[model samples]
Target: MNLRLRSNAIMAVAEQLVVGITFFVLYGVLIRSVGAEQVGILSLVLVLTSVGQLANIGFGSALLRAIPMHEGRGERHLSIASIETSALCSALFYGGLLLIAYYPFQYLITIQAGPQYAPTIAAMMVPATINVFAMGLGAVSTAGLSSIMRNDLRAVANIVGGILCLAIVFLATPRYGVVAGFWALAAQSIFVLLATWLFLYRQLPGLHLIPRRLNRTVMRDLVKVGYKLQLQSLLVMALEPLSRLLIGHFGTLSQVTYFSMAARYVMQMRGIVYSASQPILSAFSYLRESDPARQQQLYATFSTVIGLAAIAMLSATAAAAPFVGELWIGKREPLFEGFAILQSLGWLAVTVILGSYFNAYSLGFLRYNLGSHVVMAVANLVLGVALGWAFGPWGVVVALTISLVLAGLIMGIGNARFQPHGSRFLSLSNMATLALGCAAVGTAVAGYHFVRGYWPMLASGLASGVIWAAVMLPAFAFHSERGLILNLLRLRIKRRG
Candidate 1:
């Protein structure tokens, strides 16, 4: 990657890390203040409200591809219209749906959460609904900024919004409880929505918050691409909520909190790669027509780096679960620790397949992506029911892990057909990396089971990480992109000096 692309990737990662850390702190506070059962109720409500994303009908995702391609072709007007039309459509549709479904959803929550927690959850959904709707508006701007290679601006908005969220959660949770947390989320979403639009307005001169006209051709083209994603969203949106719902139905609400918290931890770790890889989609889209060779190169580079990095991070997280769990929740909950470690392993498998996902989407291989989700949904349902029945909450987690592994394999195999000749997904180097990474994770998990005490667990985790780095260094020393990345770093360091 060139310096500009590298900078954008760094900025994107920075945004996620900052926002994730801030929210991590907020959740810690929430758990402490409101207790786990209330947080469980909060998590359940938020997950249900997240279905509001379906209102977008994949227009937001289409914008990520459409805006970049249009801008690259010098059709700024088309980009503007696409953004406005998508935001308007999503907000209105979601708003109407929420109004119609409010009582039914409330009844569902009442059934799921029971009478004691139902009122709080019902109230929380009000702000949570606004939060999701704001997200619909902000998703469009977020896509526009990313497509234009200005994630740095999105980073700025997110940092400020995260701080705002933290302050609200910290102060208000003490007085008002779980509803305060939803209020904070709503506040942060609106802040980000406004900030993102301001950034876009400054970046694109002809941009307007309101649309002069919605272009039929742009909307139609976006719908053509987005409709598949819309269908896919049904399965995609169901995955997490399904997990939580099953846990709640089969186990206790506290298990729901633990699972949700553990999943959040794993997701934040995965966010590092997900954020850095966001620009890969735009880059691949840009290169699809102009440079197939460069597109192949980009895919290989990201796949290697992201795959290895994801494995290493998740391995370390699994090993250090004891320390991380205690530190995160202010005490040791063996349930949460178990959930974190197993969820880390599951997400680790999914993270390794992210490059293939970007490749498929950028090249209009939507069927591959959709097919992967179908596999995920089926596996999660089948394994989740069987395993969950057999082993309780941990069984549910195992089911999730197994499902992710299966889905990832499906995606990888499907996308491999699209790779250029001689550009294989599992090169010798990648296989070696995966093998070694898996071994390290196995060692870490085994050691974690035997090792006692926080310091010993942390030391074991560090030792495993060091050994893995040492083993990988020989391979990276001769890797192709190493020289470019090193040279860029050296130049930057010298320039600073």
Candidate 2:
């Protein structure tokens, strides 16, 4: 690892940590305040927003690639103008969605909440819908900052967004309860939107935001290019939080609370690696001026570290369950024993880390939509919802884990088939081993649950985590380049040199 790359990695980690902390804290407060039904409503808003996110049609990512690479003032202006036009199209799509949410389509969501809570959820559309649009707007700036590698700015923006969200949720929840949380979510989205737009417009003056005369050719190309991601967005939007709705329907709000907290924590812990990887991958995408082989080799290296990190994080999550739950969730007894959440995190770790690497691969290939992403999204939604309904909240978590793990496995199949060598170059052995290690911990936790009940789940989690850490540290010291501790040593050595 070069010094600059090492610094970039660390900064990315720090950026995500700060963002994650602020983001999850808001979730904690919201969940703590309104209970699970409210949590369900919030979950619905997230689902809808996910759909709304597609309004941009991955234009933000498209912009990130186009802006930095294009040369000359003319090229920059055209690209920025392209993005500006895309934004209007995006706004129209979301505007349409909000209209749907308000009228006949409002029944689609409200009916799910039941008559007692239906009206409240219906009213939530105002903030929630607007929030969705705001987030899409924020994507433009986030994509811009990412292109420039302004990670600190990214972190600051997120902190501001989170704070804004927290304030709205807290203040509104008092007057309107669950609806307030959604309102606050909308507020955060709006804040980010405004900030991002201002930053982007200032940064690129040539790219006027004024509506251009319609270009049918440009629209056709843009939509065609972005269609894959749009489908993926739609599918994931539906599937990701179907679990929450399922839990709300089958189990109590308490169950939803249990699942939500666990999900939030897992995301927070994993965000460090995910966020860190984003810019690195983005930079790699632009490194066509450098060696593509070397670029891939580096991506794999990062992926391996992410793989190991997943193991470490999941292990710790397993180990921390009992004490962590006691402190954070209180004694819900049956509502949260922690094993389900832990297992879910294990699945998510593998899914998310692998997905991150694949994203880079997709960008590199400009094969962003081979249909796999959307397929995975559909699978996750169907499986998650079905399992949640069948087995209750735990069912949802388990289903989610399975879906993610499967998606991770499937990501490489096509790549392996079509690579230059006619064979996959990336090592599956390390990922497989790390995966087995995770499975061992999950199984041990599950077994403990069955045999000694939930207490043993906690104990086993701790034991598995400590054992993995101890085993991994020594093994990694000699065998692995990107082991957590070694990465630090490399960073230090580079600084000295």
**Model 1 misplacement above 4 A:** 1-3, 421-423, 445-497
Task: For candidate 2, write residues 1-497 as lDDT tens digits.
Answer: 12255555566677667656665666666667776667765665566776677677766656555543442122555556556666777677767766765555457666666678677777777777777778876776677666555555666667788777777766776667777777777777777777766666666666555545344655565566566555555555555466667776777756766776666666666666666566554455444333456555555455556556556665555544544554465443445545345454545534434534444443545343344555566666777678766787777667666665555555555444423332222346455555555555555544444443445545644654555465445444454344444653363212111
Which candidate ranks first by lDDT, i.e. highest?
1
Over 4 Å off in model 2, which ranges?
Answer: 1-12, 71-75, 169-176, 209-221, 289-297, 332-370, 381-390, 417-436, 439-468, 482-497
Model 2: how far residue 112 lies from native, Å: 1.5
Each prediction's RMSD to truth:
3.8, 5.1
Against the reference, the lDDT scores of all candidates come to: 0.77, 0.58
- The TM-score between candidate 1 and the true structure equals 0.91
Question: Clashing residue pairs in candidate 1, if any?
Answer: none
Structural similarity to truth (TM-score) of each candidate: 0.91, 0.80
Kindly give the number of clashing pairs for every candidate. 0, 1
Task: Write candidate 1's Cα lDDT for 1-497 as tens digits.
Answer: 12246778789989989887987887789988878888888888877566877777788888878876775566778878888777777777878888887778878887898998777977887898789888888888888888878899999999999999998988888889879989998999999999998898888777775645566777788889988877787776777788888899889989999888888787877788788778878877766645567677667666666776676677666656666676788776799888888878777777887777877788788777788788888999988888889888888889888877877788878877776542343667667766666676566555545554445645655655555556556655665545543543333110010
